[model samples]
Target chain A: MARSLTKAYERVKNIDWEPSYISAADKYVEATRFYLPKKALDPFKTFIREYFLMEREKESRHYALLEAASRLQGSNPEPRWMEGMKFALSNLSAIEYSAGRQMGRMARVVAPMELRQGYMMQVLDEMRHTQLELNALRHHMRSWQDPSGYDIALKAAGNSVGAGIFRALAEDFSTCDAVETSLGLQVLIETAYSNIFFVGLSSAAAQSGDQVMASTMLTIQSDESRHMANGYATLMTLLQDDRNIPLIQEAFDKWSWRGHMGFEVGLSLFADYFVKHKTESAREMSQRWLLDDFYGGFYKKLAKYGIKEPRWLPDVIRNSEWASHTAAVYLFGAWPVFYHRYDPIDEREMEWFEKKYPGWYSHYGKFWEAYQQMTDADAGMLVTKELGGLPAFCQVCQLPWIFPRPDASTGSTIEREGRTIAFCSPACKSIFENDPNHYSGFKTFYDLYDGWDLADVIVDLGYVREDGKTLMAQPVLEPRRMWTVDDIRRCRYEVTSPLRKTAGVSAGGSPHSAVP
Target chain B: MSTEKMWIEERDIVGVKLIAGEEAEAAAAVISESYPDAVIERYPAYLSIEAPKEVVFDLRQISERLGRPYDAPTFLVIMSSYHGRINVDDDRITLSSEIVRPE
Candidate 1:
């Protein structure tokens, strides 16, 4: 009887291949084939490899939970990792909302039946990610309240140091054409930039002993790898014809820079500030994955295919040294919104900075030193005096106009219909120029605060307590808490000065390189 | 300044870290078969087996070494931390850094 059942299963394995029976060409168009003629495309003999792997993703959850349990081994949550986890959890809704909607949209417009089938799995994976992240959050929330204030945080929370990038990601999926969206969101964002989280950030999650964060990220990454491949397949299939070259190149320029905007901010802040230990600098990881591998290696391979480096490459490489440091200075002031206590850059970490990035201290250290001096004088005063005022805004990203070091950009702007629109750089201007209908006249964060004071703006954005004056500060639970002004001072003390925070485990390496 | 970069070059390399046992040996062997550059680092409890960019754990290869049937989902059980995205299916698994753009 079992043999008969196996025979029945095998009978359906051979799908109808005759072009007469609803040909893939007549009924379904290749997603990128609009740019390339059908003759230019490669024949897909079997289902794309990504489609098959996603089918297996259905079983990944069974193992993800067990793996989390194995790593936990009945210990309490590690406080620092938990803090980073909370920030990760708070930031989840933007991507979750985008992925869920985009995948469903993809099924409609995406031409090939197999490609659409793969996106169906991605839709499930994105929804699964939402649930898994919620589970991870719930596990951590058992010990403490969800510090994200995510429930109350504004829908357009791009009002601060970095959250804007997450907020902007929605449009790439929801509005862009199939080819553009796949190349941008799936290829550049999902495949390329995701390593910062899955490999680099996830490793930090593990080292900090938050198995739920680590395992959840790792499992989510399994889906990403396939979805990424699906995107890559589209690029390769389309690139087979030179007619599609310019179309793909344009996409490569725009998305690659935009993909890294929030990424530069979040990953930098996470690595430099939030981790239990400084295992790797954000700059070092960016240098490896972004420079040495992605551009130096993978993008180089594409040169033969006639694709140029992203238009923003030079500026990105220049800013790689400065992006995190630029962000860290501002983020320290915006700590409540970010949902983690800011440990003032410690002396050793500063030394780590100087060693890892030459002349980094000269470029950014004085700002840290000045902030430290201000905090030392009076922590309460530092918030009101220094961090007040609108640091300029970029028309495109809506993030603070932080670039070119030290002072904020005076900003280049175009005269438009009686008003001037300011931009952080020419690349942002060029990106804006490409689609003025969709992009231009969008309000920067500065525009949102037309008449309100900074504190009132924060209050309006739900960053205030019921009492009104108290900004809703999220506390780091251990390695010391952050309830009082003194605790804030103590957190700074832990990072810097004569008495520095010691590594709980060995500093040079982990007990097991595998686990590390 | 000695001028040697300190942070280990483990950023986007993909492989498995397994508790030392026959399973570890099986994993290491399968990895070595596919990638000549694969290396193993020994610690107190586990073996850190890795290949640059990615490591493939072909279910057929690993199962042949272990003398048992293995599913790709079982990677979660064996790996402690992997440095690249994980792609798995019935026959093969690729721990790929570049997301495997089809040639």
Candidate 2:
């Protein structure tokens, strides 16, 4: 009865019933990248055209992303940019650019005619984001330094930031089909972190006395929210096929970790150190936006649809308080070599950290005190000489393996492709294990170190000065200054004063100790 | 893996958390009057308001306090965060976390 089934299949293929020269594997992706080709079949043409018009109509409001970003419209708040602001602009610009690239790729990779519209709109939204962020940078830069600083920051820091975005969108690069790309890009990155990145950043901005930036960021968050809704709608459609649940859960685990890694660095730079005047620490903001509002309200509703939470949710919840704080110290310690300003936590600020974070003082209080003494001794301790090498990088997030100490860092170490690769956390390890091919072979800072001298590694990451020094402080303009003892001296640490006795500080814990 | 074990029938509650602001002083007064039995908890920079199972944010009352038109959606910006499903309209925003069973 089943005579020659293999031979029958071969005969059927030779019969040439296929639609076109394009193989079945490549058709859907090639066809749906943007608008379906004018030559494509009947209803698809009409549907794509109609959907395009609707998306254009929806995005008409995105122009408001620019005009004085403060809530009270037409208030004409002055533009301001500091070292932290430069760091933010650099990191944000890189992310927005990567977002546009990812969404454009999503449009090509997604197949269903019904879903193409959402990906297309997200493509437009990401473009609008690029424009909006540029406008913010330009507006503030007019009053700050050279016009070329923008170009310099982008070229210099693009590698690390772009690499982070690339690996974060690993599902997009590696998936055999479309489901995970949309979920990772649209739902996790835009939906979850938008609340933290845009909403929480705006709140922090407003409290720190820049009503302009707050308003602008809030306006951007709404567009991001709409994108999230579109993603949620896509989830609804995917749920119609029960087979998709397991795939969705897998994508959630892979991506939410990367999203967590990304925002931890971006938000903490601003919340913890950059904006001296504080509103919410990164932990509080995560609990507010991601945990309380997002999980409590949004994801709780998704339970009715049978989508379980990410498998790594326990680690995500437990580590939320310390991850960003740890990142702040790591980035701060790395200083001019790293991509942000390193503002020392003054005495009053230390008190606030203890009060706000509870265990924060026990966790990072000693490190900051050590940083204080290091500064007092050299004043420019961050200069190229004192830092022996970069911290060991997590293979997944590209962040340092700098989780809070006194506990072995919780990242899973895996033997993959004959090498021991380290991850920053269990969540990151799961992401790597999900598909090692997507993450492997990329240059970590460790890889960079392996290839070049430490100074060359610094220069490769965009820290180069025209004088050929690898360590240049930010606000990268004509008068490129190095971090001085005076910069450390200004903060109210007693060690900074020559009159005070320097005693009872945990002298430099070798940077190697922080490595996982 | 599920909230069933942690769920308490007696302690069923709905809550809204908001950051401290100029309007919060006036807004809190109006919100308290509506849910007189609601418990309000204040932290360093934010405050939380909770009732038995549902709490209504009256836009009419909020508008009267602020002396201007108020939109339910704008509360998203003013409030830091909230728990429970929120349904909004011109008149009110209701947040409810209770489970409903068929008779």
Candidate 3:
């Protein structure tokens, strides 16, 4: 059993599972200190509640599988195989929870109940897949090399991937449900994966299709389709919900862009690497069939729901091709360098990219043209001061870094409302616009300094009163003084703004003014 | 004398807005070859490839021709993968997703 399993087992076993799982899940709740503590606290709490529920569901399924596998008598390969499938399903549940957590952080916050219910079903389905896959992999473990190197990287990368997603989720206080519901959750995963990776691997596992590994993926996918339907129904219902229309629109504007972009890392990487190796272009196959049948058909049906096609929909569809091309090159070229610790990108890999992804090679040529000028032979590429941190706003999406740019559209740019919002590309802009409010809510550490509210400034300056009554400002904090948005900019040293300066004296003798 | 015009059952349109590249030329050729009657219109950022009949919007092939990959999330990918444009005339269909606004 994995160390994580032992840890999880310890955690879950201690919790009383009677009445409701949420009762046990409540122990995990911890407070996050924000500048405006009450403004979005309730929503954020609700958001985390849903997150914990999903986490609990994942823990429950994992232990159940371990228990079943341990009890099974070693008889036929069938029982052993079943154990592997259970393990795979358990892992997938974890993956879904991770994905959902990231999605929430993107500010496309789903209501606690809605997210809990939807994810609960998905959690069960994913568990089913985990069990099936683990069963198959168990038999092959002795023959197969221990998958630590790549597996560890995949897990680590996958975990960090959601952090950016959560930052995006933290944006919106309302309308998270819309974002979660809009995309047919299962269909979105199935169509994207099927087009990119799932179909090819499943086809290869025909003999062992029922052996656990293959069965797990297929079973999960089958369950995913149902989840997708649920997501679709929920979205449709939400859109039609007179109370939820505006919220739905807001959620769509935020989550659609972030969610669409989220598909890039896995979808593009798998499509270019795995699909191309299968002798068919992932982009071509998906565009010709899966996307049209799933993504397209689903979008078309939205007309009846009175939901306008999302602003990002057009761009997501358009740029998917480019994303695939970039995925082929980046993962193939960069994976060996960055992701995998084995084999430098040699002539063979380059040759494979050229043959399989000729377009990416030619396009990346431009990037390298500029890159070579800055990079050294020994150090490789140098990180410049200008490239230090992501700009206050997202370049493409304009919402923030919570949303990422698509694979190939990295350098793509956009402009919004006279503000030169540089997105990694145009696709992000579409997605970003889908939920500007959510993206706008992504306050940086610097926001505390810039806000006119004296209380906000004091808290931002890292000054806290022991009694929680008064905060003293520090003079040396220059880093926090830096401001964004020329209009909202304020002085760091003193309460210079006329409104606050006058209000502070009038309201009370204390230099601190109530935050507006 | 009255002339009888032929009735068209379905005039589905497949369109692509190609970002600048060598793929621009390749996309054009593919469009011309696959969709002979396609209406090709050029813009500063992208080339709009539109056809009356269905045409495959293969990003790999297009980018292969152009030399740059579509890097970010954009409507182009979804459009290429999915079919049917937003008929702005229809107000009932909500095109909004979690992160998108309706048309």
Candidate 4:
């Protein structure tokens, strides 16, 4: 009778649930409270001492759990050579687990019920992943005296921004805007992080030959791809809203710039960290995937919504295809800060670029030189001055700041409109011209017309209420969360760009080696 | 800083408008459960969502029960999703998505 009972129980437990699926949604959400701030006190106290005390205690508890998880027997004998596995496993566990929790917070704000449930499921899966990875790392952790720096709290601050942005979209932007920014923009971010950073980290771990990282990433990314489908689906829903058409149009123009800037930052960080150790590198793939997989894919999707591509889209596309522009941008901005920690640039880096495109090296090298002169000769004045009040708006976008450029015929320049319209290259001018109503007659461009006056324009536009003395501008004019013209201009000189040429462009120019 | 030192803070939330969807709300029900001391004040969709600190949701969950994708990534694309249809006027996250579901 006992044997018969045991056999029956085993048979019942063996059923696979994948094909005949059911969502364990509540289970997923409950599991997330393990890591996430189940109560508000946690996030608000992120900068406080009690949080540190709680973290230290929590760390100790987790360490004990880690030890308990390690001693259990596995499917095979514990080998002497598997010493490093524990450390890698623990780190991966923390990273992926935190990523899942962050996804949950983000999902609560934006994702519909089904998607939110899926994210919760992902959270549960990630917990299992952490446990498994820690088991893998246990052998490695035994040899090491301390394993402190791998805490997710430290990493979460940086990565949590993605989650934070997601939450903002759910809570802040319209459903249409929220869906576009959270789903579409995040797909780009996640795709890049999975490919560039996490994949590299996984490969660097010694026992990575099982290719477990790839398998795990592939699994998570399949979900991400599905999320992309949902993003497109929500976008279709948003597009059907007549009132939101202009908002969507306006958001596309704005967020595209924001997305590109973020992409550049991510690419630069990856190049500094991962590609540093290699003879031949993944630089080309890194550059291409960001533009092609992300930006290119994004633009194609947006076009289906009756939204035309931004004029500068082509230029951003053309620039990303070559390595030279990145060289210029990095040299002036991020590269210098990065090189302080790495090996000097090797001939191998340039050789790889040349191999990818025979003349890409020589052509861009010269362009860098010219860009350097342009930057040096026109440094201070061309960029807008930082001021207290909102700066002048662009004629076209009715936003602030444009790129500054030198006239080919004469060194003399024009600063006609209040906006400091600094063109990174000449190609952008036509983009500005194409939608003059949207762009022109911003406080700056309108001033150029002989008859128009700021006072009358402001009054007619109801800059002041019925009370004439009050300069109560439209709330739109009030500062809100935006990547303003000033922000763009700041990013221009501040971030490394490929257009500018100069060796010091990035500190200690040449592709920087990786951080150990 | 002590956990005791931290005070409950109030925040506003906002969203853009859409069609077929006359209005949307992003209120959190478990405010005390989540933030023990915090007191949340609710408002119309337009004024509150954009306030300094908030935890907002799409309210899309109420529309369906199963087989929906309501994760973080989908929410990020909300702006792009509503292009051409629901105009995000000055304050409100207007609902312009045609009301296929019955009120």
Candidate 5:
């Protein structure tokens, strides 16, 4: 009665033809080092008609929920998560859009019909994900009690210092080899790490009383399996030739570190910091999803093909121990620069953190104590200034060098062509060394605003509300008196680059690098 | 087959994470019926159905259990994430730790 999907997919794939007018090199603009065989597997065997029908059904269901949520205005969403969404959704939408562009690039350069077909569907999936995030953002903007941050979300993704991490990630994957992009993004990020964000944190979203975000994350994650299939198909095709093994290994090495720093660290922050009622700590989630599931379950199987564990797996394990806490410190320390309303972790949360991460209070306790004291605008103390200013962002990862723990930072500095470049870890340093030209051109946050006044930087970032004077960011969710541009000016805090101050220093000489 | 040639490992666990809802409950019910050894872990926001080595989702069975028509695409809507290699046809979707060699 109905045409078999496998037969239809095979028939559709047969339509692909070799062009006589142009060479294969010309047709595929980007060249990959990984050898791709002509034959590839499409495990899903996705066809266009079925794909559209499926996507349409999913979209209708999602939009219907969105409509219901809008009309009903039922749940009392946690303000902390709602505020965090301004930052999270902004970067997520941009990342998804970048992923869409990457899919287009992969579809063009990758020769296999099956892989290309999957990539085409993924292009639409990425676009849909972006729209879904934007819609969630729009809903929050319209519904949330505080809308200042949501209004400038897209703008913040471009300018916010913390957002540089995600931007670097998107840029790295988009610019790398087409096949490597699939490995980095789909296989590593989408398959391995995204569950922490989409599934694990979607639970956090629900627990935080944001059903819309929960729905959005779950729906977006549904599409990721297909994307993962696409990556697997490509990897399998490449693996058919023995020549591609080393190249694949190298890509895995670089991306494992990159994906951790750029993506997982941020998700960890959201999980640990954003959600009010947290079930699992970021460390615990990493243990379950990343270490146990991805590595033990999926990657161990790849050993048969001579694919070894990622070179940076041990380093990633070490970094994951303290990544979220360090990230939380960075975000809270430089709260004025970001667009979210932060709710400082209380005694309850502190106890939880210490329980989850043993001895957490020893390293971070003082900072939170200092943060609480400085919340009052009348105190004339900016926490950024109090904490001896923000550390230098790694040239490659775009995260601060004060990682794992600021006390025991794995960060190092190298003098390249008379300019000093900082790296968060040896992995990032090795990545930079591998292709100095690729990462060298990018500028850090301090490079742009080293000597500028704090107020001026905020104004320049356009993180101010409609009044154009009051900052969109507040020290706390609800302050007795909101800190304005004038309040920041009153504090007289000047932006200083740690890299600029310690230019020629070899390694681990950064000031204020002692917090975990 | 020799151990080295075997794509599937003894410790390999295939799983599907479904958004917690009536549909997920129904799917879990169907899966538990077929794979008696399946481990179903329920969370606040999702249901995790895991089986060692391999698991299969037959839409026809799911439809019958759901008391309505269900399709592969609709099943995908509930499944947020999965572990192990996945293969999907119109009526059936299989997740196995074993890598199916390409023809």
Candidate 6:
């Protein structure tokens, strides 16, 4: 007969004893503002031995699939999805590694035995997730026909301007209060946003013929339930003290917006734009997974404990209407700056988008038309230059000011210490206002490359393959002539900071005006 | 904008998303048998099973349906993700909308 898990867990709980030699403060190096109680729930009742055995089984199963994928070399994956993986996998692995570091920090500072035990397992889980993504990157690099983008993925993730969005998110979660990190990462991101990525997008991955990625996403998602439980356990432990309610509310308010802008926005972009054979729009996925499942199912229950809905949920819902289209504009417009081969959406997809979004074609049709025309390198046209240059990126979200829609942007600007700072939405502005110092230090894409030439910026980012002259990013997946450094230099487009031009401007300035 | 009350419907739906496979099919069969009200939605990559208020998965029943010896941890292997408060004992895993208080 099997041993009772409840009894085993109870016995395991007895093993913790206060150290006589070291004080609690000295023992736990970091301090969290959120109060943690002595007791917490570990619903999984995870034993380290069982955890390893379970994980080992999972790893063997996933790796066996990967191994088979490598040996069998099945159907050709969709080039659009394959190219997008260069950007997605790179940022994902970095985020996972940062999450692993956060777990270690949380295990140290959080006093509860159950939560800490869960955190310890999560630490390993995160590390495994990181390696799993890196392995996926390696697999794609080895197998994918055009390996230029894959070859430079990790480096590009560090240096590319678009990747700054993910970096800002990872850094924000990494540097915040340890317990707050739990709410932001585990409660909000892992629970709500990851479903869209792992379950929803993995379907897209399978449809796009990337079985390896589908397997990778599903396997990674298996670990997230435990992480969600970790967050729940921590939240429940914190709620025991009445003092923590307001603090919890504050954290929820901030992270809800932060997670949406920082994480969900990017995933939405991938879902709507990357997958060639689309199963669902980003809006539909958000409606189902985030709005219906997370907000409706989980968050409503939190009201019993005095936790209200996040302050920025309305804005989140509003932004969801056009977040993907705007993000698509940013990535597509500034193609040279990124590290992916572009696949512009066709008439079929545009019709699909219009059908799904109602007015998507009217708002975004002209841009796609111009993009298709400008794909020829011989034409000496760069779409980034033609679109009156890229707009100013929001300092808080690290996305461009033209979000939701370029024509009707909710983005605003504020002056702090005589310097102009832009925010994508009222939510972001409020987040920055909460802790000006925390966000004030972040440098935007324009900050780094305002005066540099377009060619030099790409060259400096090291977004080039082994043959250093050919650029990693192209206007289209397979261009008639690949736009090299020389080709970009011919365009003579210099990178200019939109914020610099619009300095001293008030809150309601049009993002479109700054484009030129 | 929709009202918060409208968004947060009174129905406390609890769900588990399992990776699409034989295990998911078997689990879905057991769940349908156990909880007649369970709604199983099939997607290309996974199976989404939702029930009103609560859903219980008995590993013994699942194993019987699968014609193999399945345990709780192995059951977790197929479960990609889930929402609602989760409780796992030796032989069963329960997903409930009930708020569990700390001891």
List each candidate's DockQ score: 0.17, 0.06, 0.02, 0.01, 0.34, 0.52
Candidate 4 stretches greater than 4 Å from native: A1-112, A115-180, A191-223, A268-273, A276-302, A310-312, A322-341, A357-516, B1-103
Clashing pairs in 6: none
Give lDDT tens digits, candidate 4, residues B1-103.
1111112121122122111011222223322333443344332111112222232333344223223433222222222111111211111223221212111
lDDT by residue for model 3 (A1-516), tens: 112322343344343333454652353333211111111111011123333453354335434544454455332332212222222332343455444443333222333243334444454444555444444345344323322222332242333212233333322322343244334233344333432333333432323323223333433443343344344434443453455555555445444455555444444444344321233444554453344444454444554546565556555555554554443333222221121211123344446556655454565544333333332223222221112221233432222321222222344233345333334445555555655654554433223232344334334432232433322211111213321212112212222211122432422222112110
Question: Once model 5 is optimally superposed onto the true structure by TM-score, how far is the C-alpha of residue A330 displaced, in angstroms?
Answer: 0.2
For A204-244, candidate 1 gives per-residue lDDT tens digits of 67667665576677666656655665676667767766788
How far residue A386's Cα lies from its native spot in candidate 3, in Å, is 17
Candidate 6 per-residue C-alpha lDDT over A379-491 given as tens digits, one digit per residue, 9 for 90 to 100: 98988888788787888889998877888888888777988888888999988898889888987887788889998988889987677878888888888888888888999
The DockQ ranking, best first, is 6, 5, 1, 2, 3, 4
Candidate 2 stretches greater than 4 Å from native: A1-26, A30-81, A105-114, A145-151, A161-177, A375-388, A404-407, A460-462, A465-471, A474-512, B1-103
Per-residue lDDT of model 4, residues A1-516, tens digit only: 112322333353343332235354643332211122111110010112322343343234334544553554232321211222222233345545554555555455442343343344445545655554554344333433322212222232222212222222222222222334433344434443333433333233213232333233323333343334333434444455555456556555544443333333233323432333433133454443444334443444455556666544544444434322333233222111110111223356555556654554555444333323322212321111111111222232221221221111101112334332422233323434443343333233224322333333333432232334333211111123311223223323322211123542432221111100
Ten-residue segment with the worst summed lDDT in candidate 2 chain A?
A37-46
After superposition of all CA atoms, the RMSD between model 1 and the true structure is 10.4
Output the chain A TM-score of model 3. 0.48
Top-down TM-score ranking? 6, 5, 1, 2, 3, 4
Backbone-clash count (model 2): 4
**lDDT tens digits by residue: candidate 2, B1-103:** 1111111022345666564565556567887887888878664344567776788888778888889866544554445444454444446667776422111
Native-referenced Cα lDDT, model 5 = 0.86
Give stretches of model 6 more than 4 Å off: A501-516, B1-10
Scored by CA lDDT, what does every candidate get? 0.57, 0.54, 0.36, 0.32, 0.86, 0.87
Chain B fold agreement for model 5, TM-score = 0.85
Candidate 1 chain B lDDT trough over 10 residues, lowest sum? B1-10
Write down the RMSD of candidate 3 (Cα, Å).
Answer: 20.2
Task: Report the lDDT of model 2 for residue B46.
Answer: 49
lDDT of 5 by residue, B1-103 (tens): 1111112123588899998889899889999989989999998789999998889999899889888888887788788899889988878999988765464
